[model samples]
Target: MPAHFRQERTKIVVTADNEVNIQTLTNWKVSVPFLVMLSDSSNITMPITIEDTLNQCFTQETTEQIIHLSPVCANLLRRVTASDPPFKLISVTPSPVGESGEARCIIQGKGIVSLEAVNQLGEHFLLATTYLSVGEYGIHFSTENLANGVYGIILRAADGREQRSVIVIER
Candidate 1:
């Protein structure tokens, strides 16, 4: 028989937000599950914190269940919450800039009403600046090829909502 043939698996119950409430297990070993609490409903970029479920029991099955929690979600959430205003820089994809490969700074805000992409010179590069809808906004900049420098992202809404972040490009 295999070395692990005699062990049993534990069953765990979790909430929609990835909160684990250990239900039962043959053994008592436990590994903590990751926690993900939503701070901003509009932008799912920020995270509250990184935590593990209490290991009340000490069984192989319980340990394995807690280890099953994905680390990516925990890490990302940690970065977002590191700052006063929780948000994240989604990505900087290539965009059209007078035939040059200009990267567009994509930002994920938390329940934002509107957003804008500006350069160091305080110029608006993306068109249709306002986020008419209450979801992800794609801002395309039609400026000269961005040089190796830094850019700014300003998120704002008529309801006095605002968020700011910076993006830097090497190429």
Candidate 2:
């Protein structure tokens, strides 16, 4: 079981996936540790379980990887939309991008304020959030697969008026 549904964490999870079908192989391994406290989590603060087997690996032959456990609700739908607008971020861009290149952002004050890109800045390590309506305005990111350094550019505006910046992903 290797499920992953990330909202804030470096290391992609593909949102959540679990697949196991081995009649008999040999090498098999799976791990989940980067702040994993999943003691079969029956507490639920960020508790995750998709057949609860959070960590184990003693391989011989069968191999398939990626397990972090998420997607019971997937962080209640990681918010790229779900409506939280009051927009007004204005900008979050460039700053020496490279690892994949192409990064841009903007928000005007009114509504529809959502933009996400993170690899570390305050540690919510998420990367990329989409809201496409292209033609003008601004909002574009490609970053290939992202992996360079300093990547945090956030703006999820509403009443709190959130805004953060730091993109320096040089290759």
Candidate 3:
């Protein structure tokens, strides 16, 4: 006998002794929406099971399919759609320096780049901004007017990506 029941949040459960294997299909036609709905409405504990089932079915799925299931799977598949870091910090030179000194670094990537200097007290000071082509570029900045302390040199891309490094200045 097949069992049918409804739960508090309009969740319907149907159980039967059928020999249908859901994992054999190349694409999920009816199951994706149901899994998505379960993920969005169910508690974290219950959603784990649903997420596991979705993962099993989508083992061979494409990135687009994974992205489409991310929202419903509570961002379980977010890595598939996440953006890569816009830049790589090759190196930062002269970590400890005098108040009036020059600092330089090589950054490699492609994007509109901007930088900020943040103090311990959470104060942000703009350093530089420019568009970089798809290659390695050099960055130079002066600490002539900066006070003696530690500061974070933050590099940001127009696409909202960021990288940070620290520097200490002493008199």
| Strongest candidate by TM-score | 3
Q: All candidates' lDDT scores? A: 0.36, 0.41, 0.44
Better candidate by TM-score, 1 or 3: 3
Residues 61-110 of candidate 2: C-alpha lDDT, one tens digit per residue:
22434433333322232212112222344555555766433333333333
- Tell me the tens digit of each residue's lDDT in model 3 across 48-134: 133234353323224322212233423222111212223455545566745432324333455777767788898887767788755
Question: Which residues of candidate 3, in runs, are more than 4 Å off?
Answer: 1-86, 99-110
Q: For residues 1-171, could you state the per-residue lDDT of candidate 1 as single tens digits?
A: 001111123332222223222223212222334333433333223223334455432233344442233333222211222223323334434522232322223334433343445677877654335444323345544434444455554545443434344444543
RMSD of 2: 15.7
When summed lDDT is taken over every stretch of 10 residues in candidate 1, the lowest stretch is: 1-10
- Give the 10-residue window scoring lowest on summed lDDT in candidate 2: 77-86
User: What value does the lDDT take at residue 42 in candidate 1?
Assistant: 30
Cand. 1 Cα-lDDT: 0.36
